[model samples]
Target: MRILAVLLMLTMLPVASAKEPYKAKPGVAGNITSVGSDTLGNLMTFWADRFKGHYPHVTFQIQASGSSTAPSALTEGTANVGPMSRELKESELNYFASTHGYEPTVLVVAIDAIALFADLHNPIEGLSLPQIDAIFSITRYCGGEQPLRFWHQLGLEGQWANKRIQLFGRNSVSGTYGLFKQKALCNGDFLPTVNEQPGSASVVQSVAYSDGALGYAGFGYKIAGVKTLPVSPGDGPYVKPSMVNIASGDYPLSRFLYLVVNKPPGQALPLLEQEFIRFILSEEGQKLVERDGFIPIPERLIRRQLNKIAGDV
Candidate 1:
């Protein structure tokens, strides 16, 4: 009887460990406000929901307008947290410095790739960065010396030959838009003919339905009817935006997603805010990142962010 009981206990150990939930240390209850990037909106909401399960008294006010608006919300004291898909502009940082006398804390939470998409029926297989620049920019830069207005310029044949390229992209307010302009367009202005959408989803939807449409958005927003185009840096061997490619730095458009906060000099973050950020950098939180279709920050980056947070505290 004793031997049988020992065997049974051993058999249940693995199951018990697998079913154990992540434990988060509780903190003071308060309302937490977040505003920023539409790209990080869904992921932030998921984090809030899970965090609330640990601290039931905590409430969240989240607004995902655009990354460009995050700086204003933080400076105005309307939001305590800012989620952004791109790095803060120098002007934004300077504004915070001028107001608070210090720089805000920036933490990288995940990785994303800006994917170029076209209607599934489009025969074009891929594009170089220069080609993309020419397609979207009014004043082409990099290696794209002339504007590519028609499909024939991109080597498409048959009915696509002379068809005018229908461009769709995020508006000026989007961080994704800014990043695309910087990396793909080489800081050139967008063409006047481009249709500016309000959100990533809108860009994907427009491209998926319009036969001649081409647009760019985060990899997570890819839809079924649209095909993602492989991209190269003005050369051959174009790479698709895949998990492995983005993680390995093979994807040209890959970028880090961030969480921003203003911490007073020589002071720690607010109790609730610190706890929330701790939870976000935890292994369980990174699991949520992977679940949401974004790449998790690697272990090394995670350790660096945690150490930075500790230093701030």
Candidate 2:
């Protein structure tokens, strides 16, 4: 009977201890506001959906003006966080430091391949980096009166030179523009004839309708109607834009996306900010990244970032 009672007490202790209700950290309640980077806007939306489970009391407010607006919004105290697809420029950083007295903490979320797309009906299969550079750099190729209208004129094997090349691009404020300028053209100025759209979806749609249309956008915008052009840095075969290719660094145009906050967010900010960033850097989050048409930065790199961003949490 003594042994029986002792065993029963141990079982009861386990059950009693397990009944203690779980509670989050004391400072974990509130709302967080983020602005900028239309290119990454969908990602934040996805994170917000899952984040509420971990932070029931926290609310997330997000906006997509453009990547360039982040630092200004941060310094002006209009937003607690900023989502940007481009690395912060030195001038912007200096401005933020001078105005806000601290540089914003940058958090990399995922890598996105800048996908060059064309109309599905267009037969051209590949483009050399130089040809691509020439197409976008010189107005005479796509803009002037005697534009290279056919596929053959653009150096495609077929004799289709008169098929006018319709140029599409993101608006000047877009991070896609910045990335394209840096990676594709090496900061070359965009030709004046390129038509600019407000978002990636629009770019995809516009390119899909024209026979010789060409546009650049983040990987997330790749869809069936528009065919992605293979991009290479001259080291290997033209690489298709895909998660596998981007993750392996086979695609030359892929670049990192980042989350920027005005400062180490104040205590008033929602706890979901950290939790959401943690989830984005987690294996599960990275899987979502691949599923969303971007490549997950390698696990080793992600672990390093986790250490820097959320290791203590």
Candidate 3:
């Protein structure tokens, strides 16, 4: 009877000791605040809503005013997380370092390709980087190219030829605006005639409604009335801002989106903030990226991010 009981106990041990997959502990509930990047606002909202399902007691305060506002918010301690469509500038990092004595943690959350849009009826199919510079820059500083103010300069004819190119873009406060200036305009000043809208959706809408309008915006803002234009670097074949092209590095304007977190020296991320980052980098969370029209971070990158979060780097 003792030998039989030992055998049964040994059998039960295997079942009782089996390890389950790790899930984050629901630590103390608190409000998690995020700010910056109007371009990432919708994506952040989706994440916040879904995250609430797992952490029902936690609340979120998200502010997507613009990417330029993110660093300031972090410095002031108003935001715990900053979702930016572009990487933080060196000055912004320095500001955080000044206040907190450590640089903020940056997690690349998604991939984006900045798309150039034209009115749906426009027959022009593509533009080179220099040509984009000529269209949007006052000095045409990218290649010393001639300013292309009228559609006729681009080889249009008849009524289309006489029309002035209507320009639309995000305001200076926006990351999209900064990126377009850097990538397309070669960091030159925007042409004074260009209309600077407050957001990406507005840029899309402005171009969509105008007869000869052209604008730049993120791929997620692609709408029915505007057509995406393939773009070429000076030496390469033109590539559209599709997921495959962006992922393959064929798209010239592709960039990484980031989630910025403040962590002072010798400290770990707050419980709620760490859990939120874990969720955003998880497989289930990446599916939301695809659903929201952004490219999910690749598995290798995800692993790197997880290691960073774990302070293993």
Superior by TM-score: candidate 2 or candidate 3:
3
Residue-by-residue lDDT tens digits, candidate 1, 74-182: 9889999999988889899999899988888888888888999998989998999999999999878767878899999989999999888999999888899998999
In candidate 1, list every pair of residues with a backbone clash: none
lDDT computed for candidate 1: 0.84
Which whole-number lDDT from 0 to 100 does residue 43 have in model 1? Answer: 93
Of candidate 3, the 10-residue stretch with the lowest lDDT total is: 12-21
- Stretches of candidate 3 off by over 4 Å are 1-24
Per-residue C-alpha lDDT of model 3 across residues 226-264, encoded as one tens digit per residue: 899999897577888899888665788877788888875
Tell how far residue 171 is off in model 2, in angstroms: 0.9
- The candidate, 1 or 3, that scores higher on lDDT is 1
Error (Å) of candidate 3 at residue 298 is 0.9
Candidate 2 lDDT, tens digit per residue, 1-313? Answer: 4321232233223121111122335456577788889888887777676666667887988898789988888888888778888888889989989986767777667778788898776777777665666667653332233334456676656544666678888888888898787666666777888899988888899898876789888888877888888876754588887777775556787677888864343332235566566667766666666677776655545544445554222
lDDT of 3 at 13: 34
Off by over 4 Å in 1: 1-22
Cα deviation at 208, candidate 3, in Å, is 1.0
The CA-based lDDT of model 2 is what? Answer: 0.71
What do the candidate models score in CA lDDT, each in turn?
A: 0.84, 0.71, 0.82
TM-score of each: 0.90, 0.81, 0.90
